[model samples]
Target chain A: MKLKIKDVEFKNPVLTASGTFGYGNELEDIIPVNELGGIVTKGISLKPRMGNPPPRLAETPCGLLNSIGLENIGLEKFVKEKWPEIKKIGPEIVVNIFGEKIEEYVEIAKTLEKEGIRCIELNLSCPNVEKGGLEFGRSERVVRNLVEKVRENFNGVIFVKLSPNFTDIVKISKAAEKGGADVLTLINTIMGMSIDAENMSFKIPRKVAGLSGPAIRPIALYIVYRVYQEVDIPIAGVGGINDIKSALEFHLAGSTLIQIGTALFIDPWIPFKIIKGIEEFLNKKNMEFKSIIGYLNKKRG
Target chain B: MRFLEEKSEIINLIDLGKDYYQIVISAPEISKLARPGQFVNIKVTGSLFPLLRRPFSIWSAKENYIEVLCKEVGIGTKILREKKFGKISLIGPLGKPFPEPSPEDIVVLLGGGTGIAPLSFYAERITENKKIFFAGFKHLPSPYLLRRLEEVCETLIIATEDGSMGFKGLLSELIEKEFKNIESEYTKYFVCGPYPMLKVFEKILPEQRTFVSLEGIMACGFGICMGCAVKKKGENRYLRTCTDGTLFSLKDIEI
Candidate 1:
């Protein structure tokens, strides 16, 4: 049931997505977080982000909308104040890095690489922000350039997280792979909006927000399956994956790894339970866990 | 962290008037760590919907037991009331606590409905200070909570809207009347209740010394979700109630 990406080996393929887990220290009082495969931290930037205005989040039918805007302390504060506590958890830590400019991304990536963080997830597609992420992610040239620039500076496993709003996900995946990206995390939150019809205004304080949770799972799985075919790099599937069944769906769709998001707000223990459930599923069916990778792609008649 | 599965036992359950219940749990670890004005997030046993834990302020904390006064307004508290003496899972000491009061200061605690829980612990902790508790209920005081308050405070003032209890007025009126004769120099106010009550208190009291505990529906009892954020007055940034404070100096917050 174990899966290896680069030099790091996970006990299971199930891990929490960045921005969802909140550095693994917040949930420590409630649940034993070490039982999960690993944790991806909230995106850390070169400068601290104050995030968006109030009413930053709202609940939809079976999903959530967030415009948190990647609110995080800067790299200096994170490494000095927060990293020591995060390191105490002992789970394989993957630092998710974001920046407004290519140099800023390389700088943060280089810093984390030197600090002994095994992996760097380049956040090319955070929908809530005004610039950077979506701008670079939607274009093939910019994505390729940024990925190569970061890859040149950082030696750690480089993961380029992709956006769901794009029409041509395959082109972006190919560009990332061409630039020497080690992994691809499919489908950051889909760009969406909710309006208060009575007031004739946006529902969120920020007019636009990112839609996540069970609502985006189908689209995410579609992107993962599509990208897996085009790119040889390992895929870390994410988006509305709440439970074991949902995670297994990504594995079948050609994702070698999976990230659980949105669902953490609903139930923090979901990732741990999903890890356990996958083992149970594999045992009952008498199948190797790795055998399911790309299993659905070939079976599609 | 050690998850003491056996420690979260419900020792007593009392039905207060107006669909409220006083639940006393024998959670020694939570009690030992909890400070006045802090809260606990509780998950009701065997409920599929409302899967998130509900945040409740610690009403009282003793050596081996802790108490929470919950108003049965939603599915979560209703399910919480049905549990027997041996079940429930809780996660807590989740939020920041009220700052300790000065020895010579006059502590005035105001609460309405279920918000009285955290203030009761504040009253219990400040034994050296002179304390006046103004409690408002729709009808008479819940017998269980009233008795618990009597054991902690120096003076207790009861007010009900319907004139079904002590004073025939609102709780804020009683607070005004109590503070009328005394000089404002020695007073420090701490309030947690309905937003309107807190809003009015924020206006009436001195800005520097008064602190109000703001309540909001929280999915994550932490800074991550940005659910329970209150805008800091005149500042661009909002502060998270779970991390920065559930208890904040009245001067810093914008109602």
Candidate 2:
């Protein structure tokens, strides 16, 4: 069960979504990291971010709202302190990078290039940031420019993580493909907020956060399907993917790789269980990776 | 360092009155590894409705059972209270343990409402140190908890805000009154409760000698989400409540 995106082959098709996996070192004792296909580190910025205020997380019906605001160790400290530890994990390590400006994004990617990172996921879709998060990602021109700058600077695989807050997801996908993005992470968390009605105050200090979990799976699947129909680039489906059934829906809708996000909070062992479950299903069906991926779209009668 | 994800069956669920409850579970492995400040994350239901797990400090662990003191404040705890004898997942003994105190030191355990849970457990573990338990409840606490604390603490002081119990004032005022009578030797205070109670301890006691267990909204009770962050004193960065500590010395954190 091998999966390839942009000439880089993955051992499997499961990965832990960024921000949800921490530094990939925390869960090493609970589950073997090397056994999975890959892991995306929590988003890193050019300069260290202190993140949002307290009460950053809240639970909704079948979902979670988080305003973490991309709190990271910054590029210098991450390379010096955290990168040494991150590279030791067995799976492919994709560094999820964010920025307040276009230059910062390029700077973070260029620094990662020097460290020989195989792939970098440009976080253009964090709902928590003020400048370059979902704001920069909503416009087609801005996405193309940002991706093109990083593509010119770094030679490794580049993934553009798209936000679902946009008007037309297919247009955003096309812009990323035209700007030389090797792959596209289909969706990020949906923008949302919660309130404590009794106190009449916002649950998160930032006033808004990203919504994730089983609540947003159907929406992610639809976006992946639309993006798959419009672009030829590989898709890494993320958001609300909890089990193998969720993962299979992404594959059937034309996703080559799937990342598990909020559900990891419930069970850290979910990724391994999903990998084994997928293997069993593939064995039972006498099918291969290519045969199942985009099968529904191909046979659309 | 030992942690278990056990489907613990509720052995007893008693309403301590005023929406507070004591849930006792038969979990031998978790009880064996349990220490003073460590907490457990309980999955309220099998459904994904209340998506994240709620964390509770280990109130007391005896023989083969561990207990948690919970107040029905939110949706998760409300659902938790309605179910009796239902099995749910429990992940523990998570977070750093309370530092061990020296034999000659006098340990003062000050608790407000459900915060009394872990302090009682800490009192049970210490036989060398002189224990003084000061508890403040909105009203009178359950007889079971009062008797249990009385059994372990050398001196038990009770207070209630509504003037229905021993001292008719806030817990801070009760501490002020009791301070004059007790000689200040090698004294250390372990305080847990609302933020205001912890603030009072920070003002009155030496930072090095005061230990406070924090309560925050945590998505992952281990260190993954970086959600439950507390500001470090005189620093720009934050410390994770789940991994860095549920119990921290007053000198290290701001409230």
- Which candidate achieves the best DockQ against the true structure? 2
Clashes of 1: 0
Q: How far off is each candidate at the interface, as Cα RMSD in Å?
A: 3.8, 1.2
Please give the C-alpha DockQ score of model 1. 0.28
Q: Among all windows of ten consecutive residues in candidate 2 chain B, which has the lowest summed lDDT? A: B176-185
TM-score for each candidate, following the candidate numbering:
0.82, 0.96
- DockQ per candidate, 2 decimals: 0.28, 0.76
Q: List the global CA lDDT of all models.
A: 0.80, 0.87
Q: Kindly report which residue stretches of model 2 are placed more than 4 angstroms away from their true locations once superposed.
A: A126-134, A299-301, B182-185
Query: Candidate 2, residues A1-301: lDDT per residue as tens digits?
Result: 7877666778998989999989888877877789989999999998899988788998888899999988888999999988898899788899999887888888998999999888999988743254434477888898899899999999988989988785688898899999999989978899899999999999998888999899989999999988888888889998799888999999999998899999888888889899999889999999987788888875222
Predicted candidate 1 versus true structure: per-residue lDDT over B1-255, tens digit per residue: 222232277899988878888889888888888888888777675333454667889888888888888998766788788764757767677778788877789888888888888998888888789998888887877676789888889788889988988988877776677666543788888888898788778767788878888886566676557666687988767788777889889999887
